[model samples]
Target: MAGSLPPLLLVGCGQMGGAMLAGWLADGLAPSVILDRHRDDIPAPHSVVRQASDLPDDFAPALIILATKPQKAAEILPSIAHFARHAPILSVMAGKTVGGLTAALAEAGTPGATVIRAMPNTPSAVGQGMTVCFAPPTATEADRALCTRLLSAVGDVAWVADEAQMDAVTAVSGSGPAYVFLLAELMEQAGIAQGLPADLARRIARRTVSGAGALMEQSGIDAAELRRRVTSPGGTTQQALEVLMAPQAWPATMEQAIAAATRRARELAS
Candidate 1:
């Protein structure tokens, strides 16, 4: 029980929530309550309910996780404000700021509630997530540590003091997995176009992407250095890199993409 996560009240069980839940379950979580409409197959020691109203009256979770869609925050925050009085609220809703969520909870009768914000991607489902968190001044060191403990059960964890940076974090890491998957997709398509069999193309493309990621992590090498290692002068890899790394190619496109995503995140918060 020493290493186990404390009891939690998870407000949603959609893609992101479900992914974190899977990691917590695999590690060791205390008896928790999941408030979700579409989920039903949790094992013993945990319970699932369709709505917050159905939560057990005597149950008191150590932390309340608000993983609902950002659009539903206004509707969901008030319902869970009572719980916030007893426990810090950890919100995983995209584009929802700590101040905004805290204001909503206050309007619902719980003022000065400690609210922490986190951006976690879908890779959490595989226990390889990258979660970035931001906590307000009201949150205690213990609150931050609790969040790190719970989130790290899934993958790596980092924190930022400036809440404004969360928008860029959202653009880079929160939406980063899709970018990687897109790379794999393009590689597979290119392989097929080059006369490789479809099945082999898919397999090699996926493995190459995953393997490269693993190598980067395990070797702790700079990605540019790794690229240099792979790209011999005028070789096939160099030829491809030359095209991909052109001024108007991936470099510029990626910058524009992340800028667009960051702007959108800011817009959502507003």
Candidate 2:
């Protein structure tokens, strides 16, 4: 299968897992198995089972994706620990450390399992995701490359040397989509307040946000430079920027928001 991914054993098929699976399927995936209780929409050649107990005896996966909820690790890891001996585990569970997952697998009879962690956002559903991964020293370069290849099917990928940075990454990119959506919401409401028709307001607000994002991606220009290019000395955009860019406005608010999100991410770590 030229240009196809290797076999995968996906342990969960919730939002994040399903998003990645969609990208993989669109890009030509090898035969794979998805272990999920409630999903039956997977096409032929890719099997879906209700539980780990139903997994085939002779199936071998090159990579095992752990996309289950972080709290479910204790119950799930032990059941799948045997696979760890043969494949590196890539976990998309938030706040679960590589050390903690490795310890869990070891306790379940699979010692020295290679574990990698990643933070990916909801945009992955649309194949525009930004995922940041952290691989511990025990994981080989091949393990890292495998993760990159699978994740790149969805969107961009990057690596961080220090696991501690993952908290900030979660704050900035993992949770960043909500912040952008909020901007669109506010913009739409403001337009309505200005007496624009509700439907027109909604369309313009959403399009403006999405169009700006596309321009940012395709132009390859710095965001600040783009902002400068749009702002004239005494134009309407400048008038709005004057208020929004106040010392205690978006600048300070965004800093505080990111710091709070980062703090919460660290607090959630197991």
**79-128, model 1: which lDDT tens digit per residue?**
77999999999998878999899889999999999999999998998899
Query: How well does candidate 2 score on lDDT at residue 72?
Result: 88
Candidate 1: minimum summed lDDT over ten consecutive residues — where? 1-10
lDDT of 1: 0.93
> What's the lDDT for residue 59 in model 2?
87
Clashing pairs for predicted structure model 2, backbone only: none
| Least accurate 10 contiguous residues by lDDT in model 2 | 1-10
The models' CA-based lDDT, in order, is 0.93, 0.92
Off by over 4 Å in 1: 1-3
Off by over 4 Å in 2: 1-3
Clashes within 3 Å, all models in order: 0, 0
Q: How far is candidate 1 from the true structure (C-alpha RMSD, Å)?
A: 1.2
